[model samples]
Target chain A: MNVTTVFINALAAVCLVFALIKDTTKTKQALKIAIISFFRIFPTVLAIIIIIGLLSGFVPESQISKIVGENAGFRGVLTVAFLGAILHIPSLISFPLAASLLEKGASITSVAVFITTLTMIGMVTLPLEIRILGKKLALLRNGLSFIIAIIIGLIIGVIL
Target chain B: MKKMSKEKQKKGLVKDMLFLGIILAIAIILLLIFPEKKELVISSSKGFFMEMILILPAVMILMGLFAVFVPNDVIVKYLGRSSGIKGIFLAILMGAFPTGPLYVAFPIAAALLKKGARISNIIAFLSAWACIKIPQELVELQFLGLKFMITRLLLTILFVIVMGIVIEQIVLLSEKTTKHEQTS
Candidate 1:
């Protein structure tokens, strides 16, 4: 396993042991929750895996770069920002895909925007958000997230 | 309410599985048609799968531990009791942990709202939960390098806070105007 994987697993193991020692019942509850989440998240994770395969296979890195590269400008940044908001992949998985995109020549702005919007605004989860948080707060949070995503992208593009 | 959510969760799960199946079918078809792309697709997918397999369990465990140990009520109680600058920071700090997903945060945000937490802190908390996750940052640092990860992290934090305040102000203003109109 890679360093990140090792570190994460070690951390989880440590936490689990400590939790078990502190409270067996709570630790069992944690395990149950983990298993449930793993099942619930499995399908999406697999879908993302396949999508990543298609993305890298069908579209050449050069083409991806053309769309989101340094030359793609503000429009490119906006495109990725919107794409991120619409797509519902877990943010952790997005990191490697984003890193590959960067290596392929996608601009800092587009990458940053994609990550920001992908994490912040969830178009797929909007109904749930509205149901729980009310229409006003839900709409405002998402709407403003989209705007701030672009702004954050632009600033990162400049600084980095 | 719990039953309704469980039903909804099942529906969502089925939909996701269907989507995965369709994507898998398309991928297989594409590979069959374009034999040249087979190796590229297989190798790339395998690489990502390996990467994900290693860390995903750990991430899930962290999420579970937080979900069980911390509990939503605790979050609402703490966030609700605090306000101003301290509350904002606390929200952000609390949010930075592995607290499941943004969708999960919605209900907590609603609870905070009911508990009379400031709109700005709720917004901040949500934003932080969405992007500033600790496990996510570790993954980002692994893939994107220290410089890229740190820069984006700082930038996102700054902007999210600003966005939180801005959204809160605008929302409050609109609410005031609407209330005035009603009174008039």
Candidate 2:
């Protein structure tokens, strides 16, 4: 295993051990919590991953590259920003996808917008977020995130 | 209070279903519009299924475990206002620790906010760590040039800090307005 994986495993082990040592009841509670969290989040993650994979397969890299190329300009920036807002691919998938897009002649601006929006804006997770945080807070957070993503993309476009 | 909680829960369930339906419709449309070239379908299906199998279990278990183990008090203590720079520092630290996807982070972040984490800090914690994980950065730096990686990292940190402060102010103003409305 890589150093990162080893370190993560060690950390998880340490936490588990610490919880166990502290109290048997707490340990049981933690396990239950973990199980519940897993069930709640698993289906959504699975569905998202499948959709992203399908998207990558279906969309031609050439077409994606053309629309988001450096020359695509302001329109490209807006497209990247909006696409980022709408698509909720995990970072794990996004980095590779961005790299592929870059290879296909996509501009750094588009990639930057994609990365920024990949985390900040989330169309797929909007309902879940609204349920948890309420509509006002959810809308505010997402709205601000979308706006900031465009700004970041523009800055990156100019500087990098 | 009980009645209010029940009403909210009922509303939330409906919203969740609506959202799921929308996503499914979109997915179906995409699939139809881009019917896979037969040659590529096999490879794509294999990749898609493999990723689903691997990620689903891992993400679920991690989210559940994190939700249970990391208490509100601990999150608040580290990300809370009174914690100051130390809190921000700790928030960064926690963000560095590997977790599930961004969606999982949302529920936890919301929970932290309810428990008194500043909105700005939560935004910072989510955005910075969510996008530029340290471990991921290590791998990316090797391929993407360290200069690019470092520049991105530094800028993202700055962005998170500024955004956090802005969000906190917005939240505070909203809270005050709500309080005024309640009293009036």
Candidate 3:
């Protein structure tokens, strides 16, 4: 196993021991809470992962590269940032995707903007956000995220 | 306390049984769908193990501890509307300090909102911090060049600040409209 794996395993073992020695009641409570929380969030996580996987499968990396290449210029950066906002992908997936896009000739600016916006902005999660928080708050958050994403793209474009 | 303890124990037992049953069901379904061959084993390891490592149980335990210690009132009062730019800046700072996974952030954010933390600022804090942590940036700088890392970092901070301000305005406007409509 890798260092990360070994570290994580050791951490888990420590926690497990702590749980065992702690109050039996608190241990049970913690387990219940963890299980409930995991199941509640699993469906949403699963759906997003599947959708991203499908996009990776269907969309030719070459096309993504062409549209976001150096020659694509200002429009390319904007397009990438906008796409990233819409996708609202998590970083775990976005990092590898960015790496692959770079390999396929995508501009650094485009990749940077896309990654920034993907995490910072959220189109797909907007509706759910509105429901959980109020519409006013949701709209404000998303609107600002969109605008800032563009700014980030431009700055990255200019600098790197 | 004794009665509560017995009830809790009973509840715990039931919940544990349910959790085990669900896991078993999922395992059986997966087994049926993808036969347990060497290739299947390899694929499962590649996917599940990677995810598990990232979502380590220790991280979850830390998150649980965080939830119990950090009061919602503190987040809302300091990071709430009355604090203004200072609050937003603090929020951004907090975000920059890497914590656990995104899931942990959700509960903390929700609690802050319930306690009156402004939504726009919370969003700004979460998005910015989650996206561009200082620790992560340090790693990126090593691999992706210092210039590239700094540029991305500065740009992300700028975007986060602007987004926070704009979102605040939108919320204020929406609140005004609702009040106007109610009067009408």
Candidate 4:
């Protein structure tokens, strides 16, 4: 494995050992939670992998760069931002796919915007958010997130 | 409530599985049609899958540890009492902790609201929870590079603070207008 992978796994091992030392019961509970989440997220993870594969394999790199490349302009950024908002993939799993996009000719700005919007605003969960947090807070948070995501992406594009 | 949530969770899983099935079917069909692209598709996916498999368990373990140790009530109790600049930071810090999905934070945010937390801090907390989490950052760093990750992180923090201020004002303004209409 690579450094990041080794580092992450090592960190987890240390934490797991610490947890076990502190309390076996709680550690077990943690493992249980971990397993549940692993299984729970597995399907979506596979789907994302396959989707990324198809994206790289089927779609031409020229088209990707053409649409979301450095020259795609504000329209490209907006499209990616909107797509990020709508898509329900987990943020953790989105990174590699994003990297693939970046390597395939997508602009850093578009990718950054895509990640920000994907995490910040969730169209699929809007109803649930509204139900729990009220219409005012929910709508305000989401509406503001969309605007800020683009702004953040644009600023990042300029800086980096 | 627990039963309802459990049922909802099951439905969500089923939906995910169904979605996966559809994608798998489509992928298989496409692969069959274009045999030449199979190697590219599989290799790329396999590389990514390996990366995910290696790190995901660790991430999940960290999440689990946080869930057990940190607990939601602690966040609610502390964030509820916090105010001012300190409160804002605390909210962001606590919100940045791994706590399952964004949906899980909604109830905590609502609880803080009920306890009279500042809207701006609440916004900060929610935004941080949404985009800035420790595990998520690690993944981003691994794939997107440190420069890109750090740059986006800093920008997100800055803009989120701005968004908190603007949204707080708008929310308060609308509240005032509603109260005025009701009284009138």
Candidate 5:
């Protein structure tokens, strides 16, 4: 296993042990939550894995880079950002999907913006957010996030 | 309401399964047609599947721990009292701990508003909840590596803080004008 894998698993194990020591019932409850969520998200994860496979098998690297690579420019970046904003993929799944694209030839900018928008703005949840948080704040948050997501993507592109 | 959500959950699961079925069918058909590419597709998919399976349980465990240990009331208690720069940081920090989906945070944010928390803090809390959860960051680190994850994270925090203040100012300005009109 890689360092990232080891570190995260270690962190989780340590936390669970401490939690178990302090409160057995609560720790069991946490593990229950973990199992439920894991099963809940499993099907979606499989779908994403298959899609990544299809992408590598069928799609050409040239096409991926042309659409989202460094030379794809501002318009290309915006397209991915907009796609990210609208698509309802789980944020966890989006990382692997994103990494697949990056490995193929996608720009750091496109991937960055895509992930940022995917996590930050949810078009599907807008109405509920508005009803709860009000129209102004909801709209402003989404709108501003769209902008900042691009900015963040561009900055990451420059840095890395 | 409870029945409706359970129904929705059932529908969501059905939809997810249906989607997976369709994609799986398509993959099988395509593989049968282009047998040469089967190895390539399976290898790539397996690579990602392995990468994801390794860390996801860990991520979920962390999420579960946060959900049970860090109560929402605790968030409301601290975020309701703080103000200024520290409040902004605290809001982000608190947001990072909780592991629910973003929609879950809206009601909490609304309650904090009613509790007289600063608008900026509430905004910061919501945005941070969206992008900066701890488990989510670890997944990003695993997939995207440290430099990409850290840089994007720092940038997100910076802009989220700015957006919070900007939106609060606009809301306050509009409130002031409305109050002026009422007085007039």
Candidate 6:
């Protein structure tokens, strides 16, 4: 396994062992929860795997870089930000997908914008947010987040 | 809540499986037409699949442990008591540790509001909960590398804090305007 994978897995294993040592019943419950989440997240993981496969296999590097690469400019970044807001993929799966996109020649700006908006905006859950946090707070948060996501993307693009 | 989400999970599962099936079918067809790409596709998918398999369970276990140990009430109680810069930091800290999805945080934020948590802190809490999640960040670090993950994390922290303070000001201004009109 890669260093990142090894480190993360070790962290989890250590935490699990500690939890188990503290209380067997709670640890069992945690494990059950883990299994459920594993299943819950499995489909998206599989879908991302397939999409990454197709993306790397089918889309030419030149085509990818041409559209979302360093030269794709502000419009490309905005397009991705909008899509991120609209799409409702789990943020965890989005990382792998983002990594693949980066590997496939997507610009750092677009990828950063995509992940930020995907996590922050939540177009799909807007109504629920409105219902809970009031129309004003929810709208303001989402709108302002969209702007900052773009700004953050640009800054990252510049810095990195 | 559990039952409703369970139902949603079932519906989502069916939709995703259907989606996956279609994609797999398309992949098969493409591979048949252009056999040369099959090797590329298989290797790419296999590499990502293995990487995910290694790390995802661990991430999930950590999340599960946090969910079990850190009850929502504890968060509500702690956030209800904090304010100012300290409060914003606490909000983010509490948010990053929580295991549930963003929607699950909405009601808690609302409760925090009713309990008189500052608007800035509540906004910070929600935003942090949405993005800076512990398990989620680990996945980002694993996939996007330490530099990408850390840079984005830092940027997000800075912006979320600014957003929280700005929203609080706007909300306060609006409330003040309404109160002035009422008094006049």
Top-TM-score candidate index: 5
* lDDT tens per residue, model 3, B1-184: 7698568656755655565466445544555675634344335334533553355344444334333333445555556554577777788866665344443455566667776776556876777556765534533443345677788887777777777676767666867787653110
* Per-prediction fnat: 0.77, 0.20, 0.19, 0.84, 0.84, 0.82
Give the per-residue lDDT digits (tens) of candidate 6, residues B36-107: 998999999999999889998999999999999888999999999998789999999999997877899998
TM-scores vs. true structure, each candidate: 0.91, 0.61, 0.57, 0.95, 0.97, 0.96
Model 5 lDDT tens row, B155-180: 99999999999999988998888864
Decide which is better by lDDT, 1 or 6.
6
Best-performing candidate as measured by lDDT: 5
Enumerate residue pairs that collide in model 4.
none
Off by over 4 Å in 5: B1-3, B180-184
How many angstroms is residue B63 displaced in model 1 relative to the true structure, after the best TM-score fit? 0.7
DockQ of each: 0.63, 0.30, 0.17, 0.68, 0.68, 0.66
**Cα deviation of B11, candidate 6, in Å:** 1.7
Q: Arrange candidates by lDDT, descending.
A: 5, 6, 4, 1, 2, 3
Write candidate 2's Cα lDDT for B1-184 as tens digits.
Answer: 7698558656755654566567667666776776754335335545545534443333333444555566545655566554577666567667655455566577667767776776666777777557656534643443344565676677666776777778778778987888653111
Where does candidate 4 chain A have its weakest 10-residue lDDT segment? A129-138
Residue by residue across A87-152, what tens digits does model 3's lDDT show? 644454455456546755788878887877777666766665666665666666667666676677
lDDT of 1 by residue, B116-148 (tens): 898889999999999999878877877777788
Q: Model 1 residue B1 lDDT?
A: 88
Model 5 agreement with the true structure over A55-158: per-residue lDDT tens digits: 99999999999999988899999999999999999898999999999999999999999999999999999999988888888998999999999999999999
What's the lDDT for all of these models? 0.85, 0.63, 0.59, 0.90, 0.94, 0.91
Off by over 4 Å in 3: A1-64, B1-74, B97-120, B133-145, B177-184
Q: lDDT value for candidate 2?
A: 0.63
The DockQ for candidate 3, computed on C-alphas, is: 0.17
lDDT of candidate 3 at residue B71, scale 0 to 100: 40
TM-score attained by model 4: 0.95
